[model samples]
Target: MSKHEILIVDDEPANLQKLKRTFLTDYTVHEAKTGDEALLILKERPVVAIVTDQRMPGMSGVNLLRQAREVRPDSIRIILTGFTEVEYLMDAINQGQVHRYITKPWEPVALKEALRQEIERWQLRKENERLSEELRLANEQLEKENFRLRQEIESLEPAGKQLVYESQEMRELMRLIDRVVPTNSTVLIQGETGTGKELLARYVHDQSPRADQPFIPVNCGAIPSELIESAFFGHKKGSFTGAIENRKGHFELAHQGTLYLDEIGEAPLDLQVKLLRVLQDAEIMPVGAQVAKKVDVRIIASTNRVLSREVEAGRFRQDLFFRLNVFAVFVPPLRTRRDDIVALSRYFLDRCRRRLNKPIPSFDPQTLALLRGFDWPGNVRELENEVERMVILSEPDQPIPASMVSERVRLASSTGGSDAGGLKEKVAEFERSLILEALRRHGHNRSHAADALGISRQTIIAKLKQYQLDDETAEG
Candidate 1:
């Protein structure tokens, strides 16, 4: 453990010096001649306590401490005042802005005792928070392990769902799929693009009894708006001008199997109504047909979009979303499951080598480091393409050089992904940092943060919830 840092701010030249000297023997003291300088220090580093004079040139002590609360929400704050007015100072204490206020001509021993007590309290509070977080994380990890073991995957090999992974996240996802694969319930798979949502959908179908049956995939967004209905349900020979003969629709083709609806959120409003009918009745009414034909197809929908928001926006039906979300699966982005990155890279390298008949032994260690260091915003697909490119550029019977990697990847590797995140959670930590920075830069306004991030107001609300952040932890 290291000594706690404390910040002292005062307009008087000798005052801040005296304050710094007093705490020099106890803590790491940071002296700021003005409130602005103190806030800059707070932003740059961590300080457990703030000691400031109540009077300043541009910003008063109460106001500065109030903003300091936003900068370092957990830091203890105390104010020194010599004036007769106590109304605003008391208000600051009441509002939790100032933890305590001391009068001028205070005894050094009394001030030191007060600061010690408050600092001890702050330390206790922080330790409690740290322990609570550790307990929460431990519980979550135990639950994950229990769930995976409960599925009995360790004793059995699932050849049907052969996803290449060595990550805990993937194992947990496989556990979820194992739980839902035995049933005929509809599944909705959601994730960022290139995160293998489609692959997960296939895993669900393969693990189920429907493995032997047809697996029909329909791109909801690729079909024309005028012919979407016709495409979904077979058209009669004379139904439309271009209808030459009858054809089996996806639902019919996938009878007794799985009908994958990729990008399901792109389905039009009218088509969504029809889809809901089919999901409810397991029947499809072909174009120019008076009777509905029964089909026994299991629906599996995949989307990169948020369907719940689409329902609220009236672009999607609530009933359809409810039906499709019976068994939900979220494919995490590749950057998250970095344990699989090296394995995937090697797998792709071998495949590419075999295809091209290249004698390249392997990727150089420096090259591998660059591959692992990138954020990979485009996810697995981007990585696969990059591996293929490197294979082409490598010399025969030699390890691939670091220079063979793309310039973009090289830049990302060199900067270590721009302090984006720590080792375990790059995406989340980076997102948290950006959100906090945006909040601070915009006067701790949530709306301003949302705008700065180019996301909707509701979206920012959801992000705040996802990160377990308090929306009201802002400066007034």
Candidate 2:
């Protein structure tokens, strides 16, 4: 059988025979005495190109190609007509019924060349479509693998724990995370406080090839500046007044694993230079030591502060920012993902109920609406606290009511921020005082205070920074 198929149509017997004989050496040629006959042959067999005569009985070449388009839209079409009848085929060309045409008494070589080119075009298009399908399937498989990795991480969490996401933006973010996970490249996660930046970092580490190794997480802002060097690098015995013996620092502890640097923007400038050196050389020089030890650790850093802004303000080193920002993911704040608020609220409530041994099981519609309407400046962390409080206070087996929601969320929803600035300032003032009281009640221990307030420790730390609460001097 010939490799390519071609159909030729004409009203005369001699013309049809000549055309068939011309292309028979290279193609499987089908012949028709009229346009109607050609279309009938096309319905029975697939052809790569169709060449038809313009003047025919019952149907014309243009009409046949137009109908043939519905049957084989991918076929290449050419019209055969006299030089004087070229005007008639112009309309066919304009309507997309024809690709090219040869006048009567055409050169056999020229016609053969044209048909060969059409066949090549068809083959190239089919190839492109095949490649596109392969790419689509590859992406689908990657998504599945990412999801399997995420579930593996989830298995490590307490029962009923899952990342609550309903927004398209968050779903896309998950896809991005899946693509970036297998690579050892450094990743920088930027988001507002309480937006789960660290969770994303953990996801990356868990999905990576280094999943079996330890995943060390360090809060750069929480570590005291005086001991930052010792905390990051090992300390030899008698290095300082408190150094009773040699100690392994974060780098040594995290060797062959992943090291997560949280609040990286808060690292002191002098420490940033040292951190940059370690990142560059994959080695650490411990305190009071002349020797630098090599390390094999992947770095994944996160910061709520915009490091670019910090760099501009001369607070963060530009070199360190570039090293950590090889790949970046931004976690959307809860306010922008309001659709997930109700789901997250339910999830947190379930966890709180199990922990506190409470019987409250759900939230009434009014309470759900109240939760969704709030701006949630503290994002998921604050929402969890509110739901926990509601679960603790509501009666057993009862749905949480709007009354259980804090006044800040309730009043903001009711007023619609008619006086946005004044209302926001007043709200900030109330939040600062509330946080202060919680801290005081917990003996100034941020962790205990964070647990009591139902917010993340990072959120509490961020608030303290906003209110200028000195950790060393704050009484409560």
Candidate 3:
């Protein structure tokens, strides 16, 4: 994310420097010696606030600001004036959206505090506009769903919480989802934990033809082995002890809709066979039922583990893996999509601000910078949790401060912008860190690290050479 900006205009170079020093910590300061210079800057860059001296040589501050409204209508316009310029301040207020007017020879601390408040107000307004735009786009997409599937499913948790993407990686992922959703084939989503695989699956379902139907998400790892069959295929009344009433299993519940199998790699061998049968035949037999029932269900499965490795290790069924892998989508981790960090943060901040019913605006610029600096190992879920916590700790009518941010994030920023880099650099850093940790755990043995990573020893050797870590490897 780019830095928040403040434009300080004054004919006197000393005064401009003073004003710049006041906000150098919180904003990227732009200095101008004349109204024309400031106007030229406005054309090129957007600013959060414009502070101009009321008395200038040619064009007065009020006239310059009035003209600036056409360029940056959302910017907060302020004028530093003397008592003699009260009349000009009124004209500025009436003609432009002048936020405030401070008398000449103002206290630097007081002016700084006033500007911080206005900056927060500007940030909140911009974030709100962004969120409203997202909602508008979501409604438009719902309309394009052809108006047939717009009933109860409109309230599905994916509405306001849908995938928000700014990075090209996520944009390409969404495009792939669009291409595959029309096919209605079983989709296997792969990603690390907290990468929002389930949300992506629901998004895929919402784009499918069976959108209005129920979306049943079942965690294969959470169910006990004994009750697994009953949970998937259901049981008739009195099918077994404590089975007092008939139950509709997930497949039946999601008939004509989507059945999301989360953590699919954790499914037992028997369960995998049953899943493969259902996928092939589109039919299921209830426990203790005499006949099979046909059902229309689409499969969307997600797993954190590498399923191919799971199959090779005899922990997963090869046939089931093949069936689900017909269509695949990968949700990239947060650290790899650094550009989306600020956009997603603002999205969550808007949600939490409304839900809590507080006047707390957005995060201070430094706080946001610190947030971007930290590598979100837990991904989107962890970011949301951190935002919610910061919102709760914030005071009304103020932005969340850097002091309120998590200590780990603060520590990350202590290196002074060390996290500044592009996607390839970040991804390579993450991969290198993982390889180093794996080697450390295996006493720096490259062979064991390769095995644990599901790669050949030769490939690990190449990676170690590429990362210049060959010298760190364990010697036989």
Candidate 4:
């Protein structure tokens, strides 16, 4: 609501003074004696309108306006010319550089009117731009809320599938999913690869009213970036070179069902924006089609990467992350759920043997111990594969022994057992070195050494006793 500022440039002091007096009552007038000085004023202030005399020293009025165009292209420009040259007028009109032109010996009233008109025009343009930016932000907010409400409606319905789990970690995960299933909220399932994110997504789908519908799972990482748009939102025939037939996209095919976007963090940035728009508006325009089609699918996205970190690193969009992270469920890795290791191993073993027509006994105590101790970085999938491998290779009568376990598992077990013993030895050695150094620096004064190291004399004596450092010191 501040008054609009105007800049007046003229080599003549009388012209500059006369022009300033005309607009003194209307605007905050800034005067410049030369075109170069006027440009400096334009850079320093938000002068919406500029009026310059055509015959100026060094730079002409049209040239000044042209340079001003480079600095503040939005500012309205006017030129004051005494001679009516066709070429000068053509330069002003052709380049579309000057907004208005006035002749010398002009009436004060007419010049005032032109300045007033240009100022009003500049103000109107600024208001339009401001409103446009506001509208864009408002539309984005509305779409976000619209997407949220759509999910909430689906979530209120009853569930379809119940998950199976014995470990506290997975039980907690299921309980979290139970609360999330009835709402139309978007769910982001995060975990390491092979942590059963897809299984969990299926569980959520089965538990929800949408369980009766299809549960389409798309691995975003596996899809080629170029085909991502067509894969998510179908395309028209001849949309591109390879578009031979009409295809319903994943969103359309999964209508009224669940769209499981797995490995979602790997999706291309360009696709991420499109995906965000789809979530916001619940609609997608097919490639080569002018109209967008509506879709009704519950969104449950999964990713192995830390999406919040991805946002910080500029790899993922924050707005898209917010839309997809309305609800979150984290699948526990196999190593953290130790209780399930033996049970999962046995289940996979029995199922593998039944299929292969081989009867294998349960693992022996040593093998079971090894399995429990080895950290399963590959999670449930790795355990299942290993069990299947052992079943296919092992003798039917012999119980699965520790030797049957893979070298990595055996190495992990051996390393796991020695970690504590080796760490204690390393700590004692470090402590001995520190105490010796501190004593040597303090001239072997136990009290001074304790003070230097920020410990009590008694504590240092206890350390000396524990490491038997006193005997070595006595020999020295």
lDDT tens readout by residue for model 4, 63-169:
89999999989988888887665467667867879988887787889998998887778778889999999996796466445544554565443321223456998
* Each candidate: RMSD: 33.6, 24.4, 31.3, 21.6
Residues 336-447 of candidate 1 have per-residue lDDT tens digits of 8887776677777877887788977776545666677787888877988999999998888777888899999887766674455443354455456567767888988778
The whole-model lDDT of each prediction reads 0.81, 0.83, 0.82, 0.81
- The superposed Cα distance between candidate 3 and the true structure at residue 247, in angstroms, equals 1.5
Once model 4 is optimally superposed onto the true structure by TM-score, how far is the C-alpha of residue 10 displaced, in angstroms? Answer: 72
TM-score of each: 0.54, 0.55, 0.56, 0.54
RMSD of 4: 21.6
Clash count, one per candidate: 1, 0, 0, 13
Model 3 lDDT tens row, 1-476: 66788899999888988898888987899989888999999999877789999888998888888888888988999889999878767866876558799997899899988988888888899899999999967854554353434434454433354687789999999888899887678899999999999889978887888877777889998999899889999999999998998887888777778899999998988899999999999999999899999998999999999999999999998888999999888889998897788778888887888878877766654566667767899999999999989989888877677789988777665653445564345446655766787688788888887765545688768888889986454743
Cα-based RMSD of candidate 2: 24.4
Q: Is candidate 2 or candidate 4 better by lDDT?
A: 2
How many collisions between residues are there in candidate 1? 1
